[model samples]
Target: MTLLEKLNQDMVQAMKNKDKDTLSVIRMVKASIQNESIKLGKEHLTEDEELTILSRELKQRKESLQEFTSAGREDLSEKVRFEINVLEQYMPEQLSLEELHEIVEQTIQEANATSMKDFGKVMGKVIPLTKGKADGSQVKKIVEQKLK
Candidate 1:
């Protein structure tokens, strides 16, 4: 099934099961997807577009988790962590560090990115290859180290 269809089904299941947290998160995701569709002047989004929205949501939750933890708000941190967990359930399986390294190495060779100046060139090629599978920041760090 499509991502939107799956989200709708899960949303209904959350409501029926009285899972407030899951329901809230799922609703927010739907709203984000709808907003994105409006922004693009389109009636529907592709799975790739949906994954981009999901990734953005996951990034926001991660930032919130860090902020809450640093502020000593354990309760808030816990809630954010739970939301992160829920969001993660819909994300593609993350790439392992080893797998990420291999991809970066291959991209570097393919892009002939031998210096830091070639960072963007390498990233432009790698980002799409690793999208939804690896975090951009992680991939950037790996590329930087390899280039150095």
Candidate 2:
């Protein structure tokens, strides 16, 4: 099913189960998707667009979780962690570390990235290949290690 359809179904299920946390997260994601469509002047978003919105939402929550944890706000951090879990249920299956390493190695080979100077070239190819499936920071770390 499409992401929106899945979201709608889950929203209904959450309501029936009286899952406030899950319901709130789904609503936020739906709003973000709708706002992105409106901003782009499109009636519907492609799968890639939807994934992009989801990724952005996930990134924001993760960043907030980090900030809250560092600031000793355990209560807020726990809530954000819950939100992250809810959001992740909608995301694509994450790439395994070994799989990510393989992709990085292959991309580096293809780009002939001999040193850190070729970082951009390697990343440009790798990001699109792994987008939404792999975390950008992890990809960067892999690419850096491969190049060096």
Candidate 3:
């Protein structure tokens, strides 16, 4: 099944189970994807585009949770964390540091990333390879250290 199909099934399951938090997050994801598709004049998004939306949503949730915790709003933080956990259930398993490093190194070599100027090229290659499986910021930091 496609990502959309999987999401629809999960949404139904969440509704049947009365999982309010999960249902909320899943609805938010579906809406965001639908909005983006409308913007692009498309009826639906590809799996890759769906992953991009989900990844961006997860990143935003992590940042918001961090901020909430830092501000001592434990209740808000906890709710955000719960939502994040629900959202993350759909993400691919994250790669080990070793695995990410290996991919970055190989892609850098393959793309002939020669200097800091080649960061974009390398990142473009790396993100797709590591999509939903690693933190983009962490991967960028590792790749930058290796390249420089």
The TM-score values for the models, in the order shown, are: 0.98, 0.98, 0.91
Summarize candidate 1's per-residue lDDT along 29-136 as a digit string, tens digits: 999999999999999999999999999999999999999999999999999999999999999999999999999999899887889999999999999989999989
Q: Write the per-residue lDDT of candidate 3 for residues 1-148, one digit (tens) a residue.
A: 7767778899999999999888888899889888889998998888888889999999999999999999999999999999898888888788999999999999999998888999999999999899889998999998899889
The residue-by-residue lDDT of candidate 2 on 17-128, one tens digit each, is 9999899999999999999999999999999999999999999999999999999999999999999999999999999999999999998888878999999999999999
Q: Supply the TM-score for candidate 2.
A: 0.98
| Whole-structure CA lDDT of model 2 | 0.96
Q: What local lDDT does model 2 show for residue 61?
A: 97
lDDT of 1 at 21: 95
Misplaced by over 4 Å in model 2 are none
Q: Model 1: residues >4 Å from true position, as ranges?
A: none
Which candidate achieves the best lDDT against the true structure? 2
In model 3, state the lDDT of residue 14. 92
